[model samples]
Target: RQHNLRIKVARIFNTYGPRMHPNDGRVVSNFVVQALKGEAITLYGEGNQTRSFCYVDDLVEAFLRFMATGDEVTGPINLGNPGEFTIRELAEKVVALTGSKSKIEFRPLPQDDPRQRQPNIAKAREILGWEPTIALDYGLKKTIAYFDGLLRAGDGDLARLAAQ
Candidate 1:
């Protein structure tokens, strides 16, 4: 309540959808681009690390709802889908969706990699009455389609993105 500042901090999670840069280095983009390009799907660590994937549409809805809240609701709430999946699982899904011959490549785990990333959305559910509706497979299918178009049109730094 210091300074009575009006703030609604929503901790966004791994959001993926259309219009994402292929080489943004984000997990979703990395996998989708790699899969579509028939490149190795890089999975850091044993691919056991978990992450929650949220569709952009759901995140936007949460943002709108959070902003419309009363001033008293100055929440540092987590806004993301609670569904969690391992890195390997995500890569596999991308390959399957894209039907690419990309093999799963294991990379050295970054020292700062977290073992888990599923959000505790109880507060978001109770306060903002919001939760993600788009499932990972559905979202990935859409994302894969987008990246496929970009790659087919040669619209990005393919050499640079694949290097990541």
Candidate 2:
């Protein structure tokens, strides 16, 4: 963690739509991939943990704005959707989007897992005039479509493995 040159915005709690691995450890990716593959969705802990999801495009835009900001703007701005969601809620959304009959399952909660997390994006809005425009439902739908196409194309195997 070198603190030398100018570093502008610091984006925290970034989640996105597509290109997420099918079996990656990330909750969104794991849930989507599991539903697509007809596997049970596993949530660590009580599934009450909350997180902020930011669309990929919005993240890029935030970075652009940060870079463009005058030198006066030196920040560790949280570039993420202020909207929060519980783990279970997200899993349910994934199932609905994929149209998968997968079941939700839970395992032991990981140690040090925060039960609640949502970014405070006030700085981003006030400083960069940036905000996440994509709604969660819309983003999930797009991500599901991508997963569906992969499954239909017989690329499910690759996608599933990569996701894992």
Candidate 3:
């Protein structure tokens, strides 16, 4: 306000969709790649920890909306789907969506891993009139199809890794 610079900040949450790196190590990528490869889906701890996932398209839309806002609307708003899913549920969905012959494998939780992480998108809704339109299943289907294509094409090292 003092500098009169119009600055808007957005705190984006976990996002997943097509074009994601196959081995970025994010949960969505990990699950999708492992499922596509018919490898065991690794779960940390009891797999009861929950997270909210936002489709990439919806997150991009929010970014555009936020950028187009008026100067008076400077915000550090949260931009993500408020819907949450447990890790186990996410792995199950990935397996089912990909139709992979993968099994679930549990391991000790990593240190500093949060038990639950969800966004409160109230500000984004009120300020930018934005919210995620893609459902989890629909988004996952699209993402799975993308990885399937990558595997089919044998494009990158990650693809090669996924095939094995």
Which candidate leads the pack in lDDT? Answer: 3
Q: Write the per-residue lDDT of candidate 3 for residues 1-164, one digit (tens) a residue.
A: 69867798889899999988887789999998899888999999999999999999999999999999987777799999999999999999999999999999999999999999999999999888999999999999999998888887765467464445
Where model 2 places Cα greater than 4 Å from the true spot, the runs are 1-4, 159-164
Alpha-carbon lDDT of model 2:
0.82
Q: Is candidate 1 or candidate 2 better by TM-score?
A: 1
The candidate scoring highest on TM-score is 3
- TM-score against truth, every candidate: 0.90, 0.87, 0.92
Q: Model 1, range 1-164, lDDT digits (tens) per residue? A: 68967888878888899877777789999988888777899899899999999999899999999999999887799988889899999988888888999999898999999999988999999998888899888999888877777766655666544344
User: Worst 10-residue stretch by lDDT in candidate 2?
Assistant: 155-164
Residue-level lDDT of model 2, residues 1-164, one tens digit each, is 29667767585685776776665577777787789889999988879889888877788888898899987788888888999999899999999888899999889998899888788989999999998999998988887877676677775694554454
Comparison by TM-score, 1 against 3, better one = 3
Off by over 4 Å in 1: 1-5, 155-164
Worst 10 residues of 3 by lDDT: 155-164
Ranking by lDDT: 3, 1, 2
Residue-level lDDT for 38 in candidate 2 = 94
